[model samples]
Target: MTSNFQAKIEGLQYDALQIRRNVWRALHGAGSGHMGGSSSAADLLAALYFHYLRQRPDEPEWPGRDRFVLSKGHANAALGAALARAGFIDDSVLDQFYAYQSSFGMHPDIKMPGVEMSTGGLGHGLSVGLGMALGARMQNLDFRTCVMLGDGELQEGSNWEGAMAAAHLRLSNLTAILDYNKVQQSGRVGEMLALEPMADKWLSFGWAVREIDGHDMGAIVEALDALPFAPDKPSMIIAHTVKGKGVGFAEDSYLWHNNLVTDEVYERALNELGAPE
Candidate 1:
């Protein structure tokens, strides 16, 4: 990559680091929240909101803005952090997570300024994103739709239904990104229910597929930049990630999936993550 491109990647890396920090911060405020999936998705979320998506934070309802659906809605903490950082929402809302009547709950809320769809239930986001893509096509709009999914969430058959429909319809403007963090809430996803031959499954469904290191900023950006990997098919990116990425004690552990967050634990996590520059 050229030096300018490398600098851009470095800037996104810094944003991703800040996003991870903010995820912990938001969880700490709530006293407890879904940390594992949220932390795992930070890098890709950063790339999408900061670099790829053509969004207008100041004018969030702009009709032409690309749409993003967080199918793994349990990662709303990371999404909230990214939205806050991107100026789509106020930073102070981070502290209101899960608070009484707070919109920043465990799931994405459509009422939120930048959220494309209200989602948290597994296997629903892809379908909703597919609808958005079809709407764009039908309306002759150039907007694109992207949906983020959890590896474990694939257990729901609805995703496959949506996958088939998108491919059958040749919705190239739609992209599905799977945060394949092997481990889920209870245990390793492979142990719970293996999704081996995952890429083949998407290919079998007639979508173009790519796999990348979920935590690598450059790889995340590159994969996103090369969107709609095929002209006549939807795109799928299987991003391999660790459940609790940045913090040493939390990394790869299912127990951290939705565990309590105390003051000391929060401080320790921040210390390990260090200050984002």
Candidate 2:
């Protein structure tokens, strides 16, 4: 039997920690990656893949499986980790990050069995998620749709268009989770362009918004479980997270947003994150 929600939450938390480690390991192999955004999203990805998402990794093309759109393609490292943990692929793929012919690149590709949509361009997933939900509804299928968005990606005008469309269509079966880590490529989001009243923005855009500590397994799971948050509207989760979560040196900084990973840096990162216990 599948684990209950809370137990699944616990197990997924452990899984997420391992995912974090795997993300770094993958980057260690690649020698560099988008570690900041990737690690920031580990918990949310874990919750989605391991707990909430009705995905059978061994049978990834399962018709009734829920779909996930990783809007922030830069975070593909974390998503790949979660997919491997969920058995969608062999764990050895982590060592091939950024490899010449690897499917596991810096951005998600729909060609990957478990990856529903090819994403790297911000602001594209929400609209796609709306389409997925509407398609499920039309087919009378019970599948749900989810999309993960980056904080910096919100600045893209395309997201606003998607937001307006999703609400107007009332895609209650679709949910968007914002990995609100507050920092982006060159500097803190606030310092560059603040996304203040972020929750209210989603609410005004016609989503039932909820804010939570993104790293808290309980919070992540609970928010995901309370889907739609209303009978006739889509739901949005504003997950407050750290930029480079779980690693002391990388946490809350833009420098690590696109930095090289050296053996010494990797060692320090592992020390801060600790072993997956």
Candidate 3:
């Protein structure tokens, strides 16, 4: 049953590699930008942008399109790559990342064509997504709202507030994806403040929960497909991921949290990620 999903996951990895490359490529263009969170989100972002999110690349403001919130706005590089890959923006736009007067920055901005919310505040996306879902319900629109959250951000108590409220509203239109990469800026989440029993906490809060290897494309897609796992609750997909998922030098560590780019490091990162056949 899961084999087919695995095949899709393999494809998603390829897509993710492309995204990881683009992330560095974009940062290289900017000459400076976020990479740790962005790299960690590459695979999932590829799956969402290329396979799941019902979006209109040619129509960024399509009224019927599903919405995605990059709550961990530091991962905007991956989001930007996905958006470019999905055709919402010119691929070259990434080349201008962080350029003066450029829309791309360390965080996401709603002014950008493909960005739904301007988020960088650790624990805000889920709450905003709840509002978007609730609005969809009130408007009688079938569009769903998905929020991509950071594990470090979960330390904020306000996320629990949104979790509580989403379930209270029974917002099946909503889905919160926790990018559980273990490490945050300073160190490992476990060492900082453990978020163990993660799935249980969501379930206890009235959210229908699913756990998946965040870097596995198939698991991600299936988890997304399994949305609204309960008719009476919001859904939470907890993605266990590596801090810097693709690059060997960067994975699972806090040192790369906000790194400076150099020509040698850039080449090494690209080589580590490897070129696709």
TM-score of each: 0.99, 0.96, 0.96
Please give the ranking of all candidate structures by lDDT, highest first, separated by commas: 1, 2, 3
Give the worst 10-residue stretch by lDDT in candidate 1.
268-277
User: In every candidate, how many clashes are there?
Assistant: 0, 0, 1
Q: Point out the higher-scoring one by TM-score: 1 or 2.
A: 1
Per-model lDDT: 0.94, 0.90, 0.88
Which structure is stronger by lDDT: 1 or 2? Answer: 1
Across 1-48, the per-residue lDDT of candidate 2 in tens digits comes to 246856777788789899899989988889999989999999999889
Better of 1 and 3 by lDDT: 1
Worst 10 residues of 2 by lDDT: 1-10
Which pairs of residues collide in candidate 1?
none
Backbone clashes in candidate 2 total: 0
Candidate 3 lDDT over 1-277, as tens digits, reads 5787677777788889999999999887777667888988887898888778999988999989999999999998889888888888888888878878888777888988989999988899999999999999999999999999999999999999999999999998899888888888899898999988899999999999999999877778888878878887898989988887778998888998888878888899899998878
RMSD of each: 0.7, 2.2, 1.6
lDDT of 1 by residue, 1-277 (tens): 8999899998988888888998999999999999999989999998999999999999999999999999999999999999999999999999899999998998999999999899988999999999999999999999999999999999999999999999999999999999999998899999999988999999999999999999888899989999989998999999999988989999999999999999999999999898865
Task: Give the lDDT of residue 184 in candidate 3.
Answer: 89
